[model samples]
Target: MFVLIWATFLLCVCAETGLSQKPRVKIPTLTEGQQATLTCVAPGLCSGSAPEITWTWRGAGGTESYITGSSTSFRTKTLTAFTQRHISTLTFNSSAEHHNTNVTCKIRFTGEKITEGGSTLKVNYVKEVNITGGTNVKEGETLNLTCSVESFPPSLIMWSKLGSDITLHNDTGSATLSIINATTGHSGQYVCTAKHMNNTLQENINITVIYIRTPQIIGNTIIKEGDVLNLTCSVESFPPSLIMWSKLGSDIILHNDTGSATLYIINGTTGHSGQYVCTAKHMNNTLQENINITVMYIRTPQITGNTIIKEGDVLNLTCSVESFPPAVIMWRDLSSKTNSKDTGAYTDLQNDSGSATLVIQNVTAEDSGQYTCTATHPDTTVTSSVSVIVSWFSKIQDVSECVLQAEVLTCVCISEGFPLPTIKWPLLGNHKEYAIKTTVSNHTVNSTVSLKVKNHGNSTVECVSNNEKGEAKKNLMIRSVSDTVADSSVLNVGYLEIIIAFLIGVVLSAVVCCLIKKCSRKKTKNSGNLDETLEMVTSQDDPQVFMFIWLFFFFLHNYKVFNCAQISSLLKYTYLVFWFSI
Candidate 1:
């Protein structure tokens, strides 16, 4: 019983000493390439004597070793100023291999008392940077990128574009880069960087953007007649795009090339006017543009209506042409000089049917000429011609007159008419016996006739004028001179016989005068003697008067026997002689 009690008292005292002294260990977290500290401390409350501190560490691979003052990475210290304490310090350059390592601290007291404490050591370091995600992406889609780093203490990570100084993300952990609705400008290389104390790591990735654009048609689609039809097609894209031009609803390709193409028609016509399409093709993408083409053309002008027109008649003409855009029709007088009349001039009457009419009223001979019809278009012009004809006549003038001299007679007949009228003088008898002359001026004709007379008699002369239209006649009277000359000769002979009887009476009177003179001489003697003498003188005078009368009668008979030409001369001489003697 005594041995059991003594052993129990010693065990109680030892338990009290153990409770007063304990070992402490401190292990601090550190980055790679930085200094690390692990501390082991012996309790100051020790009974009767001070304790000694020791340290040991367990490696990541489950290996264990003691740390002492002589070790290169461990150090120890003892403090006795306030109270007795023992410390063991650990020093080293940290690395990722030191993570999750176990450190132990032991305390040795007097009488062979030992106590130990353990701690876990945490270390921080950066190993490498890795990028995760696809680099190739379509435009307008979301992009996700992850930047991962293998390290201890979780290194700071950041993302940035390669060609610029802009930072996409910056944080103390793994970085994620997200881009919403990316475009072509968002393409190129990107960098992810992992940073730790005195250490940096980087990784790069290339991103590509894909897209397509619609096609376009360039140049004017409206083409003139006989002009070249030109068109071009273009598109914008990467890797170039296929371009083609074709008419709508037709498989035939008008033009085919890359990027841009041109279609040309040598001489465009109305048939070539329609809807055309421009197509641009890329990888699994197609774009099209539609264009409508119009062609303009004109046909030659045609002239119609009356070409031959008579004088004083109405004239009508029409000009027509066919065209797509409608042509301008006009009438022109080719013979402007002949169409100088204001009433029968060319006039324009335009209509919507591509035709024009030219009307002329009361056309005269001056209006006979050629006329032209012209059709004009924007690109070309055409012309046609027509001719007009006219016919007319002139008036007629004086017919016939006559004159006679001595035994010759002359007759002249004149007629003036249009279209050269035929004139005849029937009184001229033979053609050789008469002279004829004709003259013409403008549309008028003049004819003259002359005739000679061989016989003297009362007769009639006539002239006749005829033409294609009608005929006319004129008559004149002519007198004979032979009977008038014979009547004048008889009156002249009777006057000569009266002159002879007067001459005989004149001779008797002269004899009586001589007898009277003798009687007057005797009258002085006596009245009786005068009377007897006058009676004797009268008886004597009777014989003398008888003898004188016989002589006068004989002379007169002799004169009557003379020829008519001679008697006319003798009578004139005898009458002059008798008057002079009286």
Candidate 2:
């Protein structure tokens, strides 16, 4: 140390002492606002006079001045009589401005040669640690941060993010942390550390990245009837975003919260099916997501048609059901006659979105049966049934008659009609004593009526039959009492034969009389010829005359005709003899 210092001092001397000069000393490092001291000594081997030693100060700008008076004091120590050792010391308060300034010690020898040794002043101090630049950073932009401290010898500065091991910046006096294309993950608290020798200081700054992530909506878009519907919305941001749920075109808020929101629909139906929206609200920014929900349901089936119809009328039926996402419709005839198209009956089926129509044309008895309608959907099926009947007008048949037996006159009238026509007998006007019987076969109806009429002669009995459609009547003539009693001959031949017999008798009588008169008009020869002609006409000898006589007798002997067809010979002979006498 002595040789190094002695060489430094020798370099500063303007003239050679030939002997070793005093050694140079290291400048003291002074902290700001603290007391400091400095010392300089003259060479102990110097000859003569105890050389004068003084201290001067030069600023960093190169301006020089004497360090004077009360800040500087001199002390001397006696060594030997011939050569004496001399020293000087300077004292003052130190600050950061005094750092890097020059201070020098000067000595003037009695030989008129001057030499000096000087050192640069160093002061150690540090102000408080601080961070600069914006605390908030936009996403995808450059993130710049600087940390610094004012201290002599330049304090060590460090930048680091809190809760992390990695250091962002490390330097002297000032440190900057820079990240390009920053993201939301870069938001956190940052720290700046200023380290001075034996003294440490730290500063903290909270950095937040202003950014928003894409919003997400989670749920089922379609829902069944009478089932719960759930939906959720969420987003990530610096300050957690606000999430809200709402239906499109409606202002009512279904759900609202921070960070996330959930929407629920209990027992969802067709009325609740529509578009739903999930929105996330951030600082000066709004994000949204949307979804659609559908509710599936079905209603009961409805049928429309008349149960009873005319025989030839049309039978129309309609089946309808309401549901979401339309359903399929079908028609079926439950009767045995599935092929209704025959027999002038046909079923026409028409289908639409939610309904079905069945048209039965030219309805007949075969068309009268049970019919069913069905509506089918993905979830369920609906059905309805109806009954059909065909009706027709009533009519009477022609085989109606009356009969008589014993003393009691009984009448029977037969008629056939649809819906069982009723038969009524108006014998006199009204008779409650009569009885009526009816029988039915298929669509035909037979009615029989019976009554006793003891004095029913030369009168007419009336029979009337009626039904919903129409009515019919007939009359029967009553015969005489004698004819009803002992009229065997008339009854045997019937009235038709009796009429023919009478007509023949009249014509024959005329011819026979005319011939007899013609013979009588022949005069003389007359008397004898007339007698002969009479005999011939009456005798059955001449065919024309005989036929006339026979027919005449037959007309008067109607009862005889029933008794015997043969004529008695004795009676005929007597008749002839009597005729001859006339």
Q: lDDT winner among the candidates?
A: 2
Which candidate leads the pack in TM-score?
A: 2
TM-scores for every candidate against the unseen true structure: 0.47, 0.55
lDDT of 1: 0.67
Model 2, TM vs. native: 0.55
Candidate 2: segments with Cα more than 4 A from true spot: 1-26, 29-36, 41-73, 77-86, 91-97, 101-119, 124-130, 133-135, 149-175, 187-207, 219-229, 265-270, 304-314, 334-353, 376-382, 389-582
Report lDDT (CA) for all predictions.
0.67, 0.69
Q: lDDT by residue for model 1 over 123-233, one digit each (tens)?
A: 776777888987877778978899988776677889999978889987776888999998888888999988877778889999877666778787778888778998888
Each candidate's root-mean-square deviation in Å? 25.2, 22.0
Cα error of candidate 2 at position 349, Å: 7.1
Candidate 2 structure quality by residue, lDDT tens digits, 1-582: 996676556444413552246436445768788878888876554334556677888976788885433286666676544334567778888877678888888877666656688888888877888788888888889889988898866888888889887887899989999988888788888889888988989999888888888888888877779999988888877688999899999999988999988888799989889998888899888998888888888888888778777777888888888887677878777663545545645343556668888887888766767777777888688877788766565544444544554544545566655445777766635555454445567556665554555655635567777778678787754444443464342122235444544454455556556666654322234653544332332333357766756775665457544222222322333345445444
